[model samples]
Target: MTSQPTPFVIGIDGPSGSGKSSVSRAVATQLGAGYLDTGAMYRALTWWCCHTEIDLGNAAAITRAAVELPLDIGDDPSAPTVVVDGTDVAEAIRTSEVSSLVSTVATVPEVRVEMQRRQRELIEQIAARHGSCVAEGRDVTTVIAPDAQVRILLTASEEARLRRRSLEVHGATDEAAIDATRDQVVRRDRDDSTVSQFTEAADGVSVVDTSDLDFEGSVAAVMALVDAARRR
Candidate 1:
């Protein structure tokens, strides 16, 4: 029998619009690794709550939903999927309704506890299968995979983050779009901050600022860090 090679895990944390998701996915593809989006787990849980009519304000109820969530998330960087209870919800979880309320569900202590447990397990499985895995989210560095081979905290200025998010969601970077995108990028971060620290790089975790970097530039910056870490 052949022994499985040890996996190289990369943990990345960043606030919304910091480009962590896109950058991490690209890096995973470049390295022939699996990808995990921890935030999408929270979003899937929130969608389940809404689908089952669980009260988001009720901590106990939300926690119960988290415990019973039948979530199936894909690890492919090129074609990730999120499914719940046999239904594909990758798109539903990204809807405005889920976006507005996901923070509430994510802030529940028990929910984070449950989700983090599952996330750790998933990361291990993904890495074992693909030889490497790149996991990114608000707390992947601090909470989920602190001991990963490479850790990164991606960041961007508030103005730059807001503009990027506006362009992503509203398809424009005008003043109106920025104003509309502020709540999603800023308010969500504030609420999530209560549960996880992502704005600053923790000890031994490298920081990558994408405030001025375009998509390709951001990917290159993170890949450079990955290469340096492997060399060290």
Candidate 2:
């Protein structure tokens, strides 16, 4: 008879467009675990702020929104959904407008605290329901889940990251598309780094560079790290 697989938390951190979202989802799917894209929480909050016309410049108001933010994030790796209040903002939050301003809401210290709190609660709840969970975001490995069983800092060269973001945001990888996406990807990294150290690996967290790895390769690499941790 086969033994039962151990339940664990896999914390993955990386800058935007480093394939953290895709890789984490694939890893969770392979392990039959739940997946949480913490970045989407920020993005959803940004969408809410915009929807309610709350001034993004008002740090206090943003924090208030974060505290009361009615977020319903699905845990299925195959059909991940993020619903805010009574509306589904999954696709809305990914818009260029939301992407450009999400860093603003995410940078507020109080907002971060509130969102991190929600993320931790969700992680525990998901892990309890599913066998395990793969939660990925800028601070997952450091702040969100420092004691996670498997912590990974996924990184890639600037050029590679730019190409991926260009394809994702604009559905193209041409020079013009990459140039257009540079501001969003580069500037967000600058702003997000102020609150979380995702560019570098924290203590006890492994680094996975996907500059040379394809999609399947990246997924396999993360899975390998998870497997190693499970054995230990």
Q: Per the 3 Å backbone cut-off, how many clashing residue pairs does candidate 2 have? A: 0
Candidate of highest TM-score: 1
lDDT, candidate 2, 51-95, per-residue tens:
999998899999999998999999999999999998999999999
lDDT of 2: 0.93
lDDT of 1 by residue, 127-162 (tens): 999999999997888888989989999999999999
The TM-score values for the models, in the order shown, are 0.97, 0.97
Clashing pairs in 2: none
Off by over 4 Å in 2: 1-6
TM-score of 2: 0.97
For all predictions, the C-alpha RMSD in Å is 1.2, 2.2
Tell how far residue 74 is off in model 2, in angstroms.
0.4
The models' CA-based lDDT, in order, is 0.93, 0.93
